[model samples]
Target: MTANAADKSLQAEVNALPWFHQIDFGNGVLSPGWIKKSKVERVSRTLFDPLNVTGKTVLDIGCWDGAYSVEATRRGARRVLATDHFAWSEQCWGDRRSFELTRQHLAPSIEVMDIDVPNLSTTTVGTHDIVLFLGVFYHLRHPFETLERVAAMATECLVLETHLMRLPFTTEPHMRFYPNDELHNDHTNWWSPNRACVEAMLRDVGFKRITMKHPDYRRRRGIFHAWR
Candidate 1:
């Protein structure tokens, strides 16, 4: 991995694809991505600082570009499995090349699967000590049913990051539905659940305890740490 290769061959490959997570290849080569390098680094801290993953197995669902998956390996996780489908498929704007390219440079030992949200099961993917369900909740058509499946795959904890719906006047469990691309400009964006709704869903899915925080100053995003 020389500077010349990073500047020429690797950089060209990175430039050819769409990237979700901005990543540093540690050789002065960086992926020009939608999620900037600084933001991803900040989110990484917000995600990992509250807990430890050293020597633990982690499963990352919707692991586009493998940012968190690679970070788990960097934090000394015993094993990591990064999975995705829409973000890697032809239907989406991105491709699997970004994730593969990042893993080739950053964390080669990490496993990967082209698994969709509905197909996740302990029998298929095996349960993990820590499961990362980041930025995938609202995109699903069946958030509650999917939570049950996701919960079944977490042996200890589930870290869920999602776009939140603010119903400031009420504490009731409620989710707002986006019939079109009204939430974001993307059609994949479907539902946004408020704090109470998400917490309640986590409880119904078998988590003994749940905590949520908004890393950003904006009230529309949240990260839920659920312990089983």
Candidate 2:
């Protein structure tokens, strides 16, 4: 096949599925994803720039389209596992095709699991040196409990990226509950916790050192690194 024909075929396959993360598949073809490329690149830098995943094991929870998982492998992680359930099931509008295609064209060596947040544990998933919990905390109904589970599987560091709420006027940790599609008109969103709340929760979960930084896109959305 000619190069142009290969590019067209790749583009057609990518267009067949819905995507959440914009992934560049080389050959001048990029997936038509809802998340912008700039935003994803910015977030990726924030998530991956500071840390060295060389020869490390990584677990990316809620890896909707295998964006971070593939990147982790590219960044030198020896073993990277991309796991999700809702995103790959009929429970929601999305399925695993986009991720499957992306991983097929990008990094096939990376591992995958059809696991959900509640099922994640040290026993079920085993301990990884780095665990990525990006854009998933707020969507979960049980943030604290889920964090505990994620912490258990993260033997060295856990990088969490989530929607944040600013609860002004008090130093005490607080979280804003969204009973419905109150945030961004997405019903899947459940809670947005403040920075203080997140830090406190990390401490409670056994992280010794914690640091939080705001991303460039949103006003309060933060990416936190908790070290065990």
Candidate 3:
């Protein structure tokens, strides 16, 4: 087959996957998954899709279900490491069963590791071409410090996604909800951060070439693409 024909075939196969159908975004409607619908995926496809990843390394931090890791491997990453704190009991939409299901589905191309975030070290995870921090930062108490550690393990790029508070707001703008407080303790809950605070934190950690983009659909959240 010609290269165009091969490309079309691959695209068709990817589109036919179950994940390409729709995501169960919690409330219903079965919207398309972020990879199929969000700006982050579009941006990633534009920048990195052409690169050959047959022997490259990728690390996915807070890889809740290994979805991104699976995609990385499918795109030709030789090895993809998916790590998470595995404290799903503390998730805002807490569901341990769904996490396991995701793990099972991504078993072939991804390696899942359960580790404590603060204690992450080179001994635990070595360096990689890309390190993804999708939707993990706001959940941490020391977001900047954690990014520093993650940077040490990333040789090229770090892709991050998190909730950002609007500008002209103080830390006070961030509120604490006690909805799941009784179950997981106060520390294991959610945090909403302001964009300025997040940018300042990243700059202080020595991230360069920072590019921020709001998701096409979920304008409330943002994606930060940076290099060390």
Candidate 4:
């Protein structure tokens, strides 16, 4: 079978799973099956669509359920590492089962690690050709520092997806910060960041090429790609 045909078959299998049809993002109740399938589809399209992934090493930070890791492996990544804080709560299993299932489904190519994000070092999870940091910045207290650390681990590309603050030209309400709190919590639904601030931060972290994507000009939300 052709490579494209194989990929389509894999994608179809993932989408056909029952969990993919039921995910409650508003309530933060993600079906691990759905999250894994959707992330595989999105990351595969975004990162692997233009470039060849064979023999490349990919790192997925804050990988909730090995979704991106699975897709990277399927796309020919030689090695893929999935890391997350795995901070479990009463409501969530912290994606433990999903990671294990993904590992069982795809062997050798993907490795799952439960580690604290702030303590990430070269000794723990080595550098990679591509790094994915998705839906994590808003929750971090030191977001710029986090980006710097993630950049240090990426040899080629970094894909970041987060909530952005509306700029002055945009017709969106300013987000209010909690007293003495630089981080967003369950109480705070969103912590929007201005484009200028994010650009400056990325520059400071040694990212040369940067591209931003948003649903609209209103700057309600966005994703960014930074290359070293």
The per-model lDDT (C-alpha) reads 0.90, 0.90, 0.62, 0.65
lDDT per residue for candidate 1 within 1-228, as digits (tens), equals 776865788878888989888898766678888888888888888888877899999999999999999989999999999999988888888899899988888899999999888888998899999999999999999989899999999999999999998788999999999999898787889999999999999999999999988867767899999998
TM-score (all chains, Cα) for each model: 0.96, 0.97, 0.65, 0.72
Taking the tens digit of each residue's C-alpha lDDT, what string does model 4 give over 64-137?
Answer: 65656776787888888888763322334354554554466555558878787788866789999888887777
Q: Which ten contiguous residues of candidate 2 have the minimum total lDDT? A: 211-220
Which pairs, if any, clash in model 1?
Answer: none
Q: Write down the TM-score for model 3.
A: 0.65
Candidate number achieving the greatest TM-score relative to the actual structure: 2
- Preferred candidate (TM-score higher): 1 or 2: 2
Residue 13's lDDT within candidate 3 is: 40
How would the candidate models be sorted by TM-score, starting from the highest? 2, 1, 4, 3
RMSD of 4: 7.6
User: Which is the better candidate, 1 or 3, if ranked by lDDT?
Assistant: 1
Error of 1 at 149 (Å): 0.5
**lDDT tens digits, residues 35-129, model 2?**
87888888888898878999999999999999888889889999998999998898887779889898898999888899888888888889999
**Which candidate would rank higher by lDDT, 2 or 4?**
2
